[model samples]
Target chain A: MKIRKINPAGQREPPAERPIKRRATKIHYGMSEIVITIVLVILALVIIIPLVVPLLFSFKTQLEFAYHPWALPKAIRWTNFIEAWKAVRIDQGLLNTLVVCFGSIICTIPPAILAGYVFARYKSRVTEILFYAILIGYFVPVQMVLVPLYRMEVSLKMNDTLYGLFLPMAAFGIPFWTLIFRSFFKSIPREMAESASIDGAGHWRTFFSIMLPLARPATVLAIIQVFMGAWNDYLLSLILLSDQNKFTMQLRVASFLNSYGTDRMPRYAAAVIISALPTLILYLIGHRWIIKGMLSGAIKE
Target chain B: MNVFKRKAVLRTEPAKRKKKDPGRKVFVFLCVLPAILFLAVFLYYPIEETFRLSTMKTTGLSNEVFVGTDNYEKLFRDEEFLAGLRHVFSWAFWSIIIQLPLSFFIAFSLTYYSNKLTKPLQAIFYLPNVLPSAITAMLGKFVFAPNYGLIVSLGKALGWKWLASIDFLGNPDLAFWSVFAVATWAYSGFYVIYLMSRIEQIPKDLREAAELDGASMWCYARKIVLPELNYPLRILAILCTVGSLKLFDLPNMMTMGGPGNATVTLGITLYRHGFINWNYGKAAAIGVVIFVLSLVFTILQFSLGRKEDETI
Candidate 1:
């Protein structure tokens, strides 16, 4: 990779320029900058309000909710969280959700990394076709396979099982993540693997020892992303896992809210918060990684 | 891409390694085989099955008779499905025009201007994208609760008397747009996160140099950053288009495609035919069409985007 020097005009290419150069570090704050800052604040509020409103409402009593959703709760209530847990059987839902999230991650990541390495390193005609064959799956909408997926699940007697829920999700994810890992692997120089081979390391040794450790960033990005995705899944869970015991966090929360609208407004809000908690905490912790990963699959290496 | 390098490597390889080549090929096959097998069974075969099943009238995934293209023929004339297509286009229209630019601005605001609040602001904006669409849809119900939503309650509280409870989901006229608003809130942050991250990867020195050279933020964003973000933007557009076509969780869970099928999308329509009515043939037909539409649309967007890049 060659680094292109920024020409005198501050563009990547060497080009004719017109701007007058001034010293760096003294940023002039103008009216538009202030306006954009306000706009940014407003936009942040637009997002924060909806998310935070539920957190506030989760503590509001019925009368308070009816009277003033805008005002603060007089007292913080842990009972609302407990009630939300019971309303949705959120404990079970959480367990099921975690199982699906991690189970799918378990089922998906190892294969993606392995295949991605092979696809990137060992180029051949068959693998080339195989690579594109899997890549094609990325574009096929899930709805296209819905009817058959259900039929297949039923025939396999995997319906109403957690495995049924996550396995297909895993299968669907394999192609996209494989594509991501493939690109990530491609970016690493072949010389590393070649040198390792020349030192009498087998292909597996080179992959596991050298290449795999080097791919930690992509791996973390994929795990967090795939975890979030599995966490948010509803359409598949709704179709396959019909039993209440088998319900995912999404299904439970949605059903709870539907069953008892805002009648128990606080409880409903509590349920919303509880369901949103994991991803929120995850985002707050690993947002930098999440954002990078979100773009990882989209950007060309 | 490197013609001489590839030839040189090939020429330098020893014949003695041929003994190990067969084993290495086998190792490579073993590595990639899982992904190939999974996609074949789960995606490609199901796609082929969908096409086959679409041409057959079936009940309960069994007891079927061949009915060549009848399902598709009926789909073309089916009023509700056509309405669903119209709804999809409208959804795509709003998503591309409104959601795309709003995300761009949010990303632009976060990236172009350096501030202490940038990370936290970006984090908050990105939260909606991480939340399940189901949860967001439920929130939409709460937001437009008519009887209890702030719009009505606050109207009552302040004694301003005329904020008539707008039936956002109940009214046939407003269901689509109401859902669109929810979709915007839920999905706009998604693109912004990607755009912001992608934009941040733009060399900071280039930006600093431009700024010091008296190039305003707007001019830098327009002339330099936009071109750099060309690939991601193109992807976001395709995603928005395909996403609109396959939309399910929010509208379906919230409205059940009602206000009398007024907000029905292709996805909801497929769900209705397959799961609700057990009209597998028709459902599969819808599926086939949806798949083809996404494929065609994706290819079209990719080509158009490539053309734009060439011009750039």
Candidate 2:
């Protein structure tokens, strides 16, 4: 956490030597900076074009896009949005999405907290072994488990139900959630728990009343992340819920695109936008926490 | 105190002297049992099944015979399977070549620009990571249509037919790059965000010291920042390597390894064999191959990652 002072220009680092040669090289480079800038700008365009163009095209009349492929729509076509929404039964699918998101969170987060507590608070070797055994699940590809999960669901008569999607989603997410919560819990000073213990509070009382309150920030971040994951998931919903009525938004969008054909491309675009709205809103509100959470998990290494 | 202790001793029952709390034990069990059961049924069980299926031969509606290592043998001889492996390697090769450096450059710019434009620029770049791969691929498909793509327009103006001259996803030589491009676009942002975080963590003293010594921007960048980014770069290399080996979505979504198996990767090949063709045994064999490859690379990754951490 301590700060250090280092100058960018005057450092003894080998890279500092290039400044004198930089000007001469620039002249020799012959408008190379401009070219490079243009090239990078184009590359940026290429990367962003797909995300932007369709969004624009989805608003224009197909005829307009055909006539002027690069121009903005002369008129805003609100109907395209509605048509796509209705075509996908966005209403029902949104409800289904909400259910899966909240349901999975409901099923997973508490267990993650409890498991995390055990892993954090206990010293038994069995706990460590059990925790690693669970961690192995995170490495296996979802495809590898899909067929077996499907078969099991069928046998259990849970197929095509919200619970079917909820169970697997929750199961897959627990390892990550548990890891996050454990890390959070580990960061909390044990003195707090000891103090509570000395005060004659039960372990459960200390955990719920003291430690849980301390973990609120991490808990909020976890819930948002787990919700986004469950909400945006496609392959699980694709395999589990065969019925249209039961489909989550992602599967519904795929089905809508397939059935509607390309003529209604605008509507498909609208459907895609609608499908992504919850995530977009979630990101806008909690973008800081999401990025920080991801960095904490991935880049801390 | 002696009198009080005597009274307490008299009141203490022998039955309660050795009482132990069962609550914590029950709590541990309750917390872990569901996850264990889930993994056993869902992950480990399927893996065991895949291993079993790899060694078996089936002929009838309900027939399976043990045939040790035969599926793996067939896998090597299958030209298509080998082609898939080659395909995956090529895609990974191109993605690493283009995406890694590009991500670093973007990260560098985001960190170094250090001006009014930084936050908005970083946010703009982070957009692709949140959007699902499905949407990203679909958008890539839209932009790559020769007549519609901006590149096609530029090519037309330049009197070049690069857009129409090459079938992006149809040609064997070109489809790999097409899928790789999409992969790069989607993942480069992720790496950029990753590296930017690391860059931010680099002690400012290094930069200040370099600056005090009259280090040019380029010098400071090449010597100071790049060295600092070494750990993440190594991580990115391992991640991209294994990720490309197990590459599935972009290829599957954009090309479906298509225009005649041009972009078919190990993952797509596994799916095509196991799920599509109902060749469960062969698919399982391919799964075993992928699993082996991933395991070896992952172990290597962990070691390298560990060493990098130790140095840091």
Query: Highest DockQ: which candidate?
Result: 1
Chain A TM-scores in order: 0.84, 0.78
lDDT of 2 by residue, B1-312 (tens): 999998888776552333224666776787777767766766777778778878877553247899999999999998778988998777667667888898888788667656555665566567677766555655555545445444553455466875535556657777777777777777787788888988988999998788657576678889999988777787888788887787776667667778787878887787787656767778778877887777677778768866765432
Displacement of the residue B85 alpha carbon in candidate 1, Å: 1.0
Candidate 1 regions with alpha-carbon error over 4 angstroms: A1-28, A68-82, B1-14, B203-215, B301-312
For each candidate, what TM-score against the reference? 0.89, 0.83
What is the C-alpha lDDT profile of model 2 across A1-301, one tens digit per residue? Answer: 0112255555355655566655665564346444544554565666555655557767877666556646677888888888877877767877898999899988778888888887888768899998888777656666555545665677788889998898788888887778777867887889999888668776678888999999887777677777767865776786688888998766665666456544445655566677666666776787777776666556433
Q: What is the lDDT of residue A53 in candidate 2?
A: 52
* lDDT (tens digit, per residue) of candidate 1 on B63-181: 99999989999998998899899999989988989998899988987877768988788878877887777778877776776677645666766776666466778889988988999
Candidate 1: true contacts recovered, fraction = 0.72
Residue B117 error, candidate 1, Å: 1.0
Off by over 4 Å in 2: A1-47, A59-61, A78-92, A256-281, B1-21, B58-63, B146-166, B308-312
Best by the TM-score measure:
1
Span of 10 residues, lowest total lDDT, candidate 1 chain A:
A16-25
